[model samples]
Target: MPRRIVIVGHGMVGARFVEEVRRHDPAGERASLTVFGAESHPAYNRVLLSTVVAGGLTAASIGLHDPDWATRRRVTLRTGVAVTAIDRPARRVLLADGTSEPYDELVLATGSRAWVPPTDGLLAEDGALADGVATFRDLDDCARILELGRPGGRVAVLGGGLLGLEAARGLVGRGVRVTVLHPHPHLMERQLDPGASGVLAAALGKLGVDVRLNVMAKRWTPELGLECDDGTTLSVDAVVVSAGVRPETDLADDAGIAVDRGILVDDRMGTSDDRVHAIGDCARHPGTVSGLVQPGFEQAEVLAGLLTGADPAARYLGTPLVTRLKARDIDLAAVGDPLVEPGAEWADASVEVLRFEDPFRGRYAKIVLRHDRLVGAIMLGVPDAAASVIQLFDSGAPVPSDRLALLLGRALPGEATSAGGPVGSPALLPSGALICRCNTVSKGALLTAWRAGATDVAALSKVTRAGTGCGSCQSAVSGICDWLAAAEPAELGEGAA
Candidate 1:
């Protein structure tokens, strides 16, 4: 009697959608779920692949789903089974194994695939990855890089974006000499300004990473290293390509779903057909950007609410993106439009740009405010300021009058200050403040889990799904746990008295 929901592509977003739906329909009174994943392994956090390559995390550590998770929820999860086609007339999906399954509604979370350039020797004649070259995208790529990248070996990473830089840093941690080739002159040009990029480059240089800006890989081979556009060759044992990713939209396109660069969806994550819905990297809604897990997770929550009738009026306006780089020895977080050109529109208008740069110390902080509200910020080498800025941005709180003090990690006028300055504390954060952007977990949710006897970080993670994605919020989650532990004894002492 329950509506059957068939989901394609069991990546992070898809797995999350399953969890959301099950949470709403715990008794299976509304919907029965079936998920088809093309990958052989269970869903894992793609953002933590760099940490796995760096030997900090194992393949199993970053997994999102537990054993028998689907079984306990009465969901059918089929891994290693690709959905070949969608038969709209019959409302059934064809599988690679020549089987078919009928559905009342369908969801696509195929996510995206790494896009490697057409450089010579990067791909074989059959379109497979050639020897000594890999794209840093998924768990398989991490395994390949780990096997190829030996200590004291040489590695060439093509691309200077976030993933590329992370890959380069991870290889460096493995004692491999790394050279990053980027077409853009600055690192993370999309998220960082040129000034911040320079500071980051200096930090990377100190960490023993060779950064080659404004360069492109013209060709590559196993015998010879990457050949640059400028007629230069560098010898390397392995080549890791972090060029970028393209959404996997072939299934949606072939099935008559509206497709642009990604599958187009509405506010409720519904596709052209009423019976079909899409979310995650494959879903392109207004104001939604790909490659960030937060938007996809938000879309999943919205769609689940709509599907389960838990909140029929629920709508996804869009996610406020917070970008964090998880590379070792580097701390950087960028939110909104931090990169604004001088003399450009909004430069002299309501926008106020405050910047502090210490190039020698490899530190930079930039905050963009509009009408005295935090809109965008870039913080590097300033963890305390980064936390406060992120809180202000997430909460849409008013900026204090002492803007410079906030940028310099000093306490505001009414705030309590420590000897080292006022570091943002979990206790100080608003309950609604986001603790996990990827999963949209809030501080209140974490506290609720803590009150339910999930005292440690690991237990809290399982209960509230905090500190799971990208693992950037682990420090924040730990801070909350520490605060709770310290507060519990005080409450117990007061009760005894």
Candidate 2:
């Protein structure tokens, strides 16, 4: 008999694992699988939950279409079933319901939870785990914040990271007075530089968000509001903590899995115990636990190979370059180290520095380059340039003599060398061209599945395993389904949506 697999979490990483496992054994001949999710609702896009409150999507619309995906894959999905403990010695999982399930091979995809700092008086009259003070990490958290929607309401968002800013933006759009407090001076410190962060700070200020920098939240006063270390207090209601995430390795720790910051694993995503594996934000392979979606998907791919009895030799190097998808503005991106070299001297014009700052128009574009290498770039009103920049960085192609021309379609004299491409050809598509990056499914694969009679996005997901991770790619995948249905001359149903 095939080995029984029990996956702990049904979030993005776990969901991708299910997709990969099923895709590897579509005929359900290789393995028996089960997924236990802590959340009652089916998996939705956690990344875009802020967008849901910002009027970008609805509650039902945010959820994944494959509610019975596990069932279809012959993998049992137990939503709201919390796994309290794992008995690795016996290869069994202890559930909160006092039921224990045995597995020959176990995968702990238990994703991370939001790190909530200890605060003062912010909690309800009840205690620390109060109803009022919350963290926006899941759909239920989004719902709670949405429930607190009142015009001109004072709301405080702690952390000032991407999630915090997104949450503040959503709250502000809803007429809530939003203030973002961060201990650090810059936002998205990990992804952006000081100069870019300065630009972002100014942009956020224009949005009526009071951006507090270099001031840590000392404590919380239930009545007066947040107490800052700088001896100042902001009178606000409700504090949403977005202060990063710690890996969910408690289960792994209890199960005697080697862990350092996160559950330790190899390139194959296998734990020290060969029969066990881990993925997503939970697993720290080679001193890294990638919290980003791309790395997590890559990890899923690695784990998928291992479970299917493949060579599993494909090593997962860390994601060196990545694109940032801003919610409502310019594409502020970083590929490799964009920081300036110490004591390096050069004329400003010699190195291309395109600066388009129109404060009145709320637009800013500054691209820093040293000898046409595409070192660093920042844009306030240019998202189209983002794709090109990412492509240039990804391919490491030598920049055309006139770098600005590539950005703005202006042909400097003698700078028209190999620009543009075959409009209708597949060569234009990135080898890693994602039909849905959220689920790590490729366009070519999705198209092949579509031609194979997987007509709708929902059916396409059940077949091709797309749009199952983050629902951000759902819009793109849905568009593809529409194209296939229209181009194929088929009578499509509501599933096309």
Candidate 3:
């Protein structure tokens, strides 16, 4: 008999695990699988929630799984069902409805929940879930915020991290006056350096967002805005908290599983109990919790290899601190560290320090280097350059011989390709390369759906949810429409034109 696997928490990680399992073991009689999710729908993309709030995407475009695909694979997907507890004694999981199911091996992909730090009056009179106070962790949260947001809404996003900034941008696109409360010295302190942060802060300020740093929310008055540590209050419509996250580990701990910051697992993602495994945001491998899709997919592939009677030589190292913020009209990506101490012996840069700051153009870029090695850099405007930089980083290409050629309106001689990209040209188009760091959809995927008969942006919106949440990618999606039309002019008709 094939091993029976039960996975809890159907977010990106859980859903991806199932996909890998089916792909590795296409003959399902070899391995039976079932996934239990607390949400109402099969895993949709959480990264695109902000876009949905901005009216650019619908529900379908962000969905990652298909019901018919699951049925055809004989994968049982149970949504709207919560697993209350895991009865390890019986090796079965107890559901909220009191039914119990047995599993030869259990995988806890419970994922993390947004950390809502304790604050004052964030509750109703009886301490119920507050109306004006919600989180942006899932699709439901985005839907609630959209329902509450109106023509003239006032919103305050707690936390200046990626999600917090994305939420603020979405609310702003909805015509809501938005304020971002961050406890750090600068926004995205983890990704961008001080110089880059300054550029980003200035850019956000120009967009009318109130960027307050080194400020912590001391309390939340649902009627008012957030009360900061300095007694200054930010008055707004709703308090959307993106304060960070704590891994969901109650079940793992209760089962006598070892857990530190998260459920402790080895490189193989096998927890203390050999019979129990974990992946995604919840599994704290010796390496950091990447919190990105790529690492989680890596974990799934490794486990899938082990389950399929393969040697399973794969081991996850860790994900670089990469930030691709999907904010309104912004394209920013940073890998490794953007800010290093002054006089640090960094990689060589063949290009001179390219500086472009035009308040009129709303663009700023600071590319740092040693000879031609990309150590760290930041981009304020000129999003088209992001892909080129990523390509350089990936290929480990040496910088151009002429240092100044890296500056504005300059491309290394003979480096320009047919796509008009630099010599290495990430070859990934800005439209398809996931300019919107939020949803993470490639331009190719969007075009595929369009050519497959999805019509109009709205219809495309329903299929891809590209511009739904943040509106930053709206223009990018429009560009994709043009690109698609140019490729197949006859099919798109006036819609593409």
lDDT of every model, 2 decimals: 0.85, 0.69, 0.70
RMSD to truth, every model: 3.0, 5.9, 6.0
Best by lDDT: 1
Model 2 regions more than 4 Å off: 123-127, 287-289, 310-312, 323-326, 340-379, 406-497
Worst 10 residues of 2 by lDDT: 414-423
- Global Cα lDDT for candidate 2: 0.69
**Model 1 agreement with the true structure over 1-497: per-residue lDDT tens digits:** 89999999889999989989999999888999999999999999998988988889899988887798889989999999999999999999999999999999999999999999878889999999989988988888899998888999999998889999999999999999999998998999999999999999999999999999998888887787789997899999889999989999999899998999999998889899999999999989887689988898888899999999998999988888788888998889898888875576777677888999998998999999888888899999987788778777777889888989889866343332211112244445556767777777777787778777999989998898877776788877877777778774653232321
Candidate 3, number of clashes: 27
- Per-residue lDDT of 45 in model 3: 73
| lDDT (Cα, tens digit) per residue for candidate 2, span 4-97 | 8888888877877777777788866777888899899877767678788677778788666456666677877889999988887788999999
The TM-scores, one per candidate, come to 0.95, 0.82, 0.80
- Candidate 2 backbone collisions, by pair: none
1 or 3: which has the higher lDDT? 1
lDDT (Cα, tens digit) per residue for candidate 3, span 39-139: 89788877677778877789777887556867987788899999988888788999988898899879888888888777775667785658788887888
Task: Give candidate 3 misplaced runs (Cα > 4 Å).
Answer: 124-128, 343-360, 367-372, 402-497
